[model samples]
Target chain A: MKLLLLSNSAAPGRSYLDHAREVIAEHLDGVTELLFVPYALADHDGYTAKVAAFMDTLGIRVRGAHTAREPRELVASAQAVFIGGGNSFRLLKSLQRHGLVDAVARRIRADGVPYMGSSAGTNMACPTLRTTNDMPIVQPVSFDTLGLVPFQINPHYLDPVPGSAHMGETREERLRQLLEENDVPVLGLREGTWLRRSHDALELGGLAAGARLFTSGAEPVEHAPGADLSPLLAAEARFDCRPD
Target chain B: MKLLLLSNSAAPGRSYLDHAREVIAEHLDGVTELLFVPYALADHDGYTAKVAAFMDTLGIRVRGAHTAREPRELVASAQAVFIGGGNSFRLLKSLQRHGLVDAVARRIRADGVPYMGSSAGTNMACPTLRTTNDMPIVQPVSFDTLGLVPFQINPHYLDPVPGSAHMGETREERLRQLLEENDVPVLGLREGTWLRRSHDALELGGLAAGARLFTSGAEPVEHAPGADLSPLLAAEARFDCRPD
Candidate 1:
């Protein structure tokens, strides 16, 4: 399967998708048209239009899956798929309601279609949406997602601020609590980072600030931009509890 | 009904329960013993013991609900109930699993048992756990919480950092997104602040940092300490979607 899972769409000073323009272009190389899933945000047309405008600069035509009469069929016929980020719960609920979870997964894993995701969309590629930082504004049918990748992903991961007086659990603490219930590895992707999976090799790429890998009985290990994370694809996911 | 919901158990540089010692003592006036629910954290025994140590200083005997032969009976017989803070999802899951949701609610509303919650515990007093700031580390049977209060509560509410490049949604943004899905109002309780309800009166009280009240379409309004929030107790909760 081919995937480009980004941590975020924008960086500090750059416009949407501007920071990783080159990487996105290379990931969608030779592809003339791409299908965009814009269900994460409330405004589907607006989100699709924003992405289309950006993809236009890269010499590609963007079609919104929401506009398709048959979204599943659109996924099946697409040369590449891109899912933008917003609220993960809303995204998963829409995907489950539209019956596109299996359809998109089949397209990516069985048909080898290139898949790209940002923020909540990046969360969609994981086994479950359990690690997302978004609030549960709405409930999905389940925490289960595409499962295109073996482990979980915590998108937009933030390290604890030094000397902050806030008592809320830091990003690391929450992920550690997750490990107490589920024996699955979590990849905390900081902003400006993207994980590219080309066939069997998975490479972390972006500007400086890298990523952190968290496992069940160990301290989180940090990785740089060029780190090889292909081994995590073989990790087994065993959940001890379910939402229902 | 009498309730004391704290945004956090400890403020900056303060020991557990120390920041709210005077208020807690007043809230638990004439009461000698309190039943503590520690299911939010994995180590129930440790959590219960920690709360017990703090409550001892307030001249109250603390009992762990986990240690009771029948937890429901313990809730029924308690002079006051205190649910310590940890993970909201885990806390709700355990409460639902042990059949304590209804029991605790009955004690608070029907029996007038004083209910005290900190952080995740504070979230339990709301209609649902949708507004909590914690990660979905575990899935509860449902997002349904105690519903001791009419609206939702977002504990540990943090303002957006000035000029920070993080692309993740701010606390205000996430709460606004929640308004899109549910018609219920939300109370964003910042640290060093709390909500206290007695009989038919509700008041925002605690340290200097105040609270933010969020409605469906209106911009959030700020409330100072000692602000009259009794009207919110009558607000209706209408959930547009359910997890199942």
Candidate 2:
């Protein structure tokens, strides 16, 4: 299976999908058409139009999964499947409502169709959507998502603002709590960075600096852009706490 | 009913519960014993001990609901109830797990027991926990919480950091999406601020500057500290979209 899980579609001072252009082109190489899941987007048509315009630069045609009479069939037949980012909960809820979660997962994990997501889209590729930063404005039937990867993806991660008075949990603290309840490793993907998986090999890449990985028993480890993170994919679940 | 829903227990450079001393004293006046719900806290014992110490200064005895053999009975017999904040989702899930959601809500809404919550705790007093900023690390049986208030509370409300590159939705945008789906209004309680309810009157107070109120279709309006926001309580649900 191949995947391009992007932290964000756009970076500050960059045009839409500009930062991810090179990666997207390489990831979707030889794919003439792609199926776009726009459920994560609030403005579905606008998101589809913008994505289609971006994909045009790569000479690929884009179709909306929302408009398809049979979304599962669309995922099954697509050359590459892309999930655009917005609200993760809403996106997952819509996918569950449309009965496309397993279908999309099957295409990406078992059938070997290329899968790509940014922000909320990337979150969908994780074992569960528990690590998403989006508000729980809507509840999905479950937090489960595509288990394309063994771990969780926290897209658009940010370091806490120095000296800010906000008392909410930092990105690190939240992930620590997640480790308390679950054994899954969490990868904090900073904006402008992404993870690429080609078969068994996984690597972090982008114009940004690096990503932070949090496992239960160890300190959060940072890896620079283009660093190999394939070991994380194969590592057995390790817990600081005793397993249930 | 008396309620002290704080955005945060303390301000930067202040001691825990320090910023809230006077208001908390006033809110809990005439109360001898207070029941503390510390489930939102990752360290329940640490939280309870600190809270008990803080209440000792106010000449009040604090009991931990987590250690109680009968949490519902504790809620029923308490002169006041306080839910400390850590994770709103965890707090709600614990209350639901212990069958204390309705008991606590009934105490505040009907039995006239004084209720106080900070951060996640403040979020619980709202119509729903949908507006919380906490990560959904765990799924509650439902997003429903103690509906002691007509509107929702977005504790630790912050404006977008100027010139920051984070592409995720701002607090305002998240609330906008919430309004899209739910008709309830949202009160953005910035850190160090809170809304006090004494019977039918609701007033915004604390050291922080002001609170932002979001209703469907209308621009968010700011309310200064000590603003008599009782009208918000009596106002019938207004929606930019058709009401459900």
Best by DockQ: 1
DockQ-based class of model 1: medium
lDDT of predicted model 1? 0.89
Relative to the true structure, candidate 2 reaches a TM of 0.95
Give the candidate number with the greatest lDDT.
1
lDDT of model 2 at position B167 = 73
Best by TM-score: 1
lDDT score for residue A65 of model 2: 92
- In model 2, the clashing pairs are none
Q: Which run of 10 residues does model 2 chain A get worst, by summed lDDT?
A: A235-244
lDDT values of the candidates? Answer: 0.89, 0.86
User: Model 2 Cα displacement at A244 (Å)?
Assistant: 11
